[model samples]
Target: MRLSFPKLAHLDIRRGLMMVLWLQVAIAAVMIAGDWLGRNPPGAPSSVPGMSDPVAPGDQRRRFDPDRPVPRRDAPALPPGIDLPSTYPDRLTFERKTIEGFGDVLLLNGSIATGDADRLSSYLDGASTEDLPATVALSSPGGQVIEALAIGRMLREAGKNTAILPGMACMSACPYILASGEQRRVSPEGYVGMHQHYYDENLYMPAYFAVEEIQRGQGRTMEYLIDMGVDPGVMIYSLTTPPEDIYILLPEELLDSRLATEMLD
Candidate 1:
């Protein structure tokens, strides 16, 4: 007859098919495990990359959050200008009086204005020389030196008793006037001081020139006071000391220095 082809066994074929299926299943399992490991690794928390945790209501961060805007504070406005009064509280006043038997005790108020040289000269000329009265006054803030000196000379020439009322302050040129008095009186509150003679430079001249003039004027003033019988030492001390540091003499102190002939209560 004819040679027939040998047929393969069914069991061998089935075993080969089973081996192929097992290989495919193993490869699928390996791929699934790798994907799981990359997505969720061990020891790492599962959260969005940049997201922060929720904060408590009482936390400081919650109070002043960067995302929130803050309210601004308003400030008060300033006044446009200051309202200062023209007149000051303290003002000097001069009062005059007459003593019948004593001729006339002219209380040269520190506030009196004898005006310019011509006017002052006329006033002095008109004054009666026979019954020229003494001047009794208290002075603190000094005024025109020329006027003060003129009054001083007049008092000295008339031989009238010039008195500085104590508790009263005689300062600057005022002391020169006091020196003119034949008698100086100091009250409990009497004080005397001197300052460098001051003049307006802008109204006069350069500083050096003004200073020279002041010095000359001061020298003349000192000479007049000294010649009129004021102690040279006292005048020197006054000239040297600043106005603020001028001599302060009580009634007793003045009497001790011979600056005052009498002390009034």
Candidate 2:
């Protein structure tokens, strides 16, 4: 006589099925909890232990709140201050501030707006009236790539060093300014990020033309990096990071990219 497996003791079969059902339920609960936490994550480090390299969505990330205005698609994951200027701030303004450890700095704050490049050039032209700051400190969410590039060239011409202290951010095209620095100093606590650049598309313009323009812009940027002594490889982060999220560079990446000559010890 042969014993069929399905005909085994009813009690034994029932117990095994119950155990599997409960295990599945427990797994579902854990996954649900993980997703909920991810919605409001405290942000993970750029380079986790045992990881080969630093990547996107790191310590600087925050939940995307619906209340915030999404400027360019390539804006930071964590929006800037509440009630702050989303578009161009009236204009990029400069203030003479004295920062600790770094001494006096010419603080450039607010969004980079149209004609801001001319404004910066004018500011430096009159810098002789007052004591010139050793460093040009940047704090902005970034705007107007063309303006940012122009400002960067002016900074490079001036031979000013750059620094970013904690409690402030330098992201997007702002890094171009940082790269222009004769010497770059950064505090790990300060946030520095990058993402793909966005250009306003004209309905009248053909797709191929738009693509060509973007390529030319990128080429100029790569050339600028080379001239600034920064590794063009750093653009890898900018290219890979999505427009919706910012890629916060780790201290190591900053050093490796030559974006920072030295960091807060």
Candidate 3:
């Protein structure tokens, strides 16, 4: 006679499996919530991760809200002489504006969003030769970095020059567009800044994959900068700066890094 082992009850085995599945579901739900909160802080724009400064930030800084400041996400008032548009544009707006120094510039004002690049491209493609802008006048707090890169490349291919007027602030990804100019110009009081960028990632993606995505984005940005004739080494400022606060480049820094091909008096 052979000894036989007792079989576990099917109901008990099924219950154990159910418990494990429920536990996993609970864990995944918690992780997704946490990631959402981290990326979309209560006071910040849920879709935007902007670069700005409030009283020369150190470790903590307010997220840029070009439309208006939130109760908790406050940034410093614009410096003297700087002016926000009469009606702040929610999305990037490109309009022909005749300025004192830069003539017939496509005043690239308003907040840049994810789809702005395509809008710009479409507008340029449809414009007549007489209406095509030779200069892109930047006056933005900046928005999505990827879109900025795309816009910059388009500007480069079109052989457009970029400039920042005295009262305009070109913080965050706006500088990438500035770098694309064959003859970049920044006024003495123009605000051109940079900071770290945020890349979109799926909630359920592994940490390794997220890191890889970020690296790829950064690599593409660096490569784009080099292609635009700006030194990629200038990204050092971007890499070191916090995403919330912009690193205001010194006038000399702009000249030295070749980010500004020329200074506007």
Off by over 4 Å in 2: 1-90, 199-209
Each model's backbone clash number: 3, 0, 0
Q: After superposing candidate 1 on the true structure, give the runs of residues whose Cα lies further than 4 Å from its correct spot.
A: 1-95, 98-104, 111-132, 199-206, 243-246, 250-258
User: Model 3: clashing residue pairs?
Assistant: none
**Model 1 lDDT on a 0 to 1 scale:** 0.49
Best by lDDT: 3
lDDT of prediction 2: 0.69
The lDDT, on a scale of 0 to 1, for candidate 3 is 0.74
Best by TM-score: 3
What is the full ranking by TM-score, best candidate first?
Answer: 3, 2, 1
CA displacement after TM-score superposition, residue 56 of candidate 1 (Å): 71
Instruction: Kindly list the per-residue Cα lDDT of model 2 for residues 19-134, writing each as its tens digit.
Output: 89999998867766664454336776533221112234354333211122222233433212222334434457787876644677788877677798998888888778466787
Q: After superposition, how far is residue 196 of candidate 1 from its true place, in Å?
A: 2.4
lDDT of 1 by residue, 1-265 (tens): 9776555444587787888899888776766565455433687543321112222222101111111111111211111221212221122333344433233455553432345234434555776664344555544345567767776776677665665443234655566677777887655434454544443323223344467777777777768857776654565555554332333333444555456677655
